[model samples]
Structure formats: structure tokens, C-alpha cells
Target: MTRHYLRNASIDQPLNVLVATPAGGTGQGGIDRIMAALKAELERRPNGVIARFAPTRGKGALALSLFHLTHFCARIAAWRLQRRLDLVHINLSSRGSTYRKIVIAACARMMRVPYVIHLHGSEFRSFWSNSSPIVDRSIHALFEKASRIIVLGTPWQAFIAERVPNAHGRIVIVPNAVEEPRVAHVGGGASVHILFLGRISDRKGVPHLVKALARMKDVPGWRATLAGDGAVDDLKSEITALGLADRVTVPGWLGPEETARLLATGDILTLPSHAENLPMSIIEAMASGLGVVATPVGAVEDIVKDGKTGLLVPPGDDSALADALSRLVQDGELRQRLGAAAQAFQRRHLSIGPYADRICAVWQDAAAAHRGEASLPALVTPTDLKA
Candidate 1:
């Protein structure tokens, strides 16, 4: 689809950008939530920036391959037709993500548009460390040419600096943010609803969470709900094997409204993930005022305060995971205190407005460097964009 509203090369023009992400809100994972939220936030006020969202990937291998071909044509059309095109913000993950964005980056470079890579992968270092030399070079080349690399946390900032030492200076840390709910989760309900929302795989520690809860059958007024797709039959088998069918509810997968309702009703959210890079489940749980009980992995350690805003356990430790949830289950006051603190932490620090502000500045810097401009007009402050 070719779209051209008004072509303006004048000094006064919005910083136009093309944001390339996956087909979000389409039964995808954390990165999709982050993309949907950030895109909406930027598009909300859009002070002087006209942003265009172009989805790149879909379900399955063939769809993903086709999406690349389809989006490439759309990107070319936008570049050819739009006069105020400034930058391309590419949201990327590990493995296939880097592999795919390499093509997008090359396309951006061909059109002489500055492109930025926003890393959302939880295991990029693992992917980078284990890849063949040829693949590593391709990854390096992609990051090396990018105008900047946006990381989720300082840990990622440092990791990427070491990963692509050549472009270390281009790394920018922008933690994930979610819109706060109007009404927070009512904690300390009659029954403690422990929620685990994510892909039901061993990597996400679904069995571990079920194992933990299976042992806690004696914990009064404590029930658990497992939401999300992937290995659902396997997870159901495991839950059945543990005799937790009565204690746990595996809902398979949830849409946005169902997910929101679950989060809003959940008192304690647990993610004993084997690994993560600031998963949006934890972020959204924090926003909804749920007392978070998660493993200290990735940016989770940075966002969740141990014993304060939320409790953090060592990854892959079922005993610790169970004990953390037990603590919340036993003490209703503790749940309220922690949930309130978690909500406050999210609003005070990780709101979407500041995240959008950082992206706006990054877009401006990328465009200015490419076009030899002095600076952006600084038209929209974070305060003005605050929700």
C-alpha cells in the first residue's frame, strides 16, 4: 500500500519515522506488547512526529519469510513517496530477529535512511556467543551500521557494548514501559490467585511453577492460573501428573482483554523463567499492582526490588519460587504493601512518556547526524506527553 499525505522538506516538519515491528496484538509475546504500547504512546500525542508502523513478521516460517518480502516493498514505497522520511526504528530479537533485520537495515541504508536497532531478545549473548563466524560477522555488520542500539537495561547496554565493541558508543538504554491501569489490582483477596502468564515451556519454568504450586496445596485460599500458548498439552500432562488440575487452571492462551482481566484479578504474579530480558509480563504485573514473585534475571533484577516492590528468587529454583509465593500467600498485608510499592515504582519511573521522550531524542539524533542538521526543535517534553 502506497501512502503519501503531504510532502514537506521545509525546516518546519515533524520528525517522520518508519517503525518496523512484528505483527503485534496477534498472539505474540513480550516484544509485541512493548511494540503495541510504545507505538500507541508515540501516536497518542505525536506532537511533531508522524510515525508509521509497519509489521515485519507473522506466525510460522513461511509467513515470516513472506512478511520480509511484503514489508520490504512497503518500506520502499514509503521511502519513495514520502518526502519527510527521517529514520527507521527496527525492533529486533535474537537469532531470526537479527537475521531478518539485517535485510531491513540494508534496505534502510540503500535508501540513505538512518536506522536504529532496539534489542528485545532475552538471550542475545547466548545466540551471539554460539553462532558461526559468518553469522557473527553479519550480526556485527548490522549493529555496526545502525545509528544507535536501544537496549532494555544497563545490563544489556554493557552486554551489547561488549558484543559490538565497534559501535559501543551507539548503545542507548531504554527500559520497557507499560501504561498504568486506571484501577489497580485489589490485593489480599479472599483467595490468593497466583498467575503465570507466558509461553508454557520449560524455558519459562512453567513446570517449575506448577511443581512449586503443586506442593503448596495446603496453602489456604491460594489458586493459580497459567495463561499463554506453547506446549499446552505437555503442560497439561505435567499438571495432571502432579495432581494439580484442581489447584491450577491452564487457560491455554489469552487475548489482551482476558490477559488484562487476569492481571487485574491476580494477587501474586510468578515467573520462574530460566532466562529473560525484562519480560513485559513482569512489567504489566507491576503496573497492575500485583505483588511480583519472579527470578532475578535480565532487567527483572533492575525493575523488581527484592523484598520491597517485589520478591526475586534465583532462576530455576523451585524451592525458592514456592517459598516466595508462600510468603505472599501467608501474609495479606505483605501482598498489599508490595503491590502498592510495585505500582508506585512503575508509575514513578517506567511510565511510557519518558520512554517515548528517549525514542524521540534518539530519532532526532539519528536524523541530525545523517542530514547534518543542528538539532530537533525540542517541541514535546516528556511532561507534555505524560498520560
Candidate 2:
């Protein structure tokens, strides 16, 4: 389908966009943070876009979660009846998230409202490949119903294109972004501080991170903080067993303000995950001008260029992780160089300013496509918009 671009569309009123996600701003997950950041950025701009946070899933019992999902579907019907809804932005993940979104998308379609699906699940491929044929068809039908399918990276774009061949033309790459850190980056005084901000689980390679840090016990000038929830007790036990009890601290979880403070004070941000969909921690670290040491999983390599913006170690490689950490801790100049480059890359591409513009364009374009007004809006670059 050829998408028409409307050069001058009347935009006196803001677009009412219903964004369905796990938990908008209050949730601790990466997708929640992304939507929260986007919502906040959109609020800051008078760009004629109003996003309503319609949280479909929450950190509650199964019954409560189901209630929220049902409520979200009903709310969509109600909003459409009131003629207040312009588009439904469905933030989807793997497994249960996909199931919930299928129902939500179906409801939105029944109400004749266009919806976009933003894929954020890291283990989606594994989940989708293992699903039954009936489930696969339902998933395919969900994609077929979407106005657009937003992916975090190019690899994901390919993945979705291969799975839903007909929806290939609708796939778009919109990497996770963060607002410029309000707190400035400052070195961790004498001993370099390494920060790990995510779930404290095996998928995140936290065990490997502890083992790597243990190898650096003989080396000095480094302290680590693994600040996140999940398997916290297990991680603590491992840290003690590795004799890194004194050097490594396992704080359960940090809120946004605390996270910002930690990001500002830390010298290096590390996430040795086995899988990811462009982890947001790296983006936040880059925005804070912290040297990043992460595994090249999913779309990590898209922004974290090895030896340039950040160092990439193979997944589950304790030795390489230790080597990367030791290198950054020992060489302050290298840290500064990498941190500066990462920060520059973030400002140019991953900052919330341009991110908000691109998202707004997608929402506008999706809305237009639903109304059969014209083709997708011309996605203007930041420079192009300024000009």
C-alpha cells in the first residue's frame, strides 16, 4: 500500500492516544520506563499529542491482572463511544503479554480504532517458536490487525518481518530512549564504581557478573552495586561465597530518583545479559556519560560499539567481563573517552527530544492510516523538522 504524506494537516486539537502497557510510570520494568519517559516527554511538548496511560497488566495476582485487562478493553469501547480515542498504542511482550494484547487489539479493531504494537519481549522468539499452531494463528492475526509494528532494533524488524510477512511493510525501528540525565556524571572518587541496574536474575547474567567481580578481587580501585529486585537473596549468597561481600552491594531496587543518583555517581554501567531487546539500562548509562560494559545481545551492538561508545563482552564470559571491568577501572582516560562518545551518541540519537518527535509522528501516521486520510506521515529527521 502506498502511504500518502499530508504536508499540511490541520492539527488544532491533540491526538488522543491510549497507550496500553504493563504499568505506565509506576512499574519497574523497562517497557514501563520507556512509556513513562515518552509520556513525560510528550507532555513537555505542545505537539498536539495527548497519550492516556491504559495499563493492561500490573504487578498483582493473576485475578487482578485479568481484571485490569478486561477493564482496559471495556475502556477502549467506552472511549470510542465517546469519540475521545484516536489511536491505541499497544505495548506488547512475549507469552502472556501477547495474549492480553490480542484481546485488547481485537476490541480496538471492533471499535474501529487503529492500534500499533510495540514489541519489547526479549524472549519472544523462543516463546513464539514454542507456541501451538492455534496460538501462532492468533498471534499472526494480531499482527495483521495492527496499523504499525514498532521494533526496538533492525534485528527485531527482520524477526517480525519473517514471522508476519504481510505486515513486513509496517515494521519500524524505534529504539528505547531516555531523557538526558538531570544529574551530571562524576567519577566514584578513588575507587571506580560499577553499577548494574536491572533484575537480579540469571537471564541478566548477575551470577556471572559476581564471578567476574570476584576475579578482580586482587585488583583494587573498584566497588560494585547491583541495584535491582529478583533473586536478591541468591545473588547476595553468591557474592558472599565469592568473597566480594565487602566490595559488592546488592540493593534490592532503586526508584527513579535513586537510580539517577546512582547513575551519576557511577563510573561504569554493566549489564551482562544473556538476552535482551535493546536494554534501556545501557541507554540510560550512555545518556549519563557512564562507560558501558555489556554483552552484544539483541540490539545492544546497535548503540554500544565495542571499544568506541562502550565495550562488549561475550555473554556469560566471566573472564571477558572481568577484563572489560578491569580495563575501565584501571584506565581513567579510556573510561572518559568511551563515556564521552556514548553520551554524544545518546544526545544525537537516543535523547528523548528526537525520540518524542519520532513517536509522535508514528502515532499521527497510524491515526491517519486508520481514517484512510492519507499515507503514513513523512518521518522527518530532527534537523529536517528544525529547518
What overall lDDT goes with each candidate model?
A: 0.77, 0.85
TM-score of each: 0.90, 0.94
**In model 2, what lDDT does residue 284 have?**
92
Q: How far is 56's C-alpha from truth in model 1 (Å)?
A: 0.9
Name the candidate that leads on TM-score. 2
lDDT of 1 at 361: 72
Query: Whole-model lDDT, candidate 1?
Result: 0.77
Q: Look at candidate 2 and give me any clashing residue pairs.
A: 3-375, 4-375
Q: Give the per-residue lDDT digits (tens) of candidate 1, residues 1-387.
A: 011112223337777788877764343567777667777776676455677776677655754666655665467557746675778888888877777787888887777888888888888878988999998888888898998778887678788788778877677777888876645566436788999999988889887788788778777788889998999988888888888888788889997778887887889989898878888888888898889999887878778889888898888778888889999998889988998898888887688777766776777666776777654334222222111
Off by over 4 Å in 1: 1-11, 24-27, 59-61, 77-82, 182-184, 373-387
Cα lDDT tens digits, model 2, 60-79, are 77668898998899989998
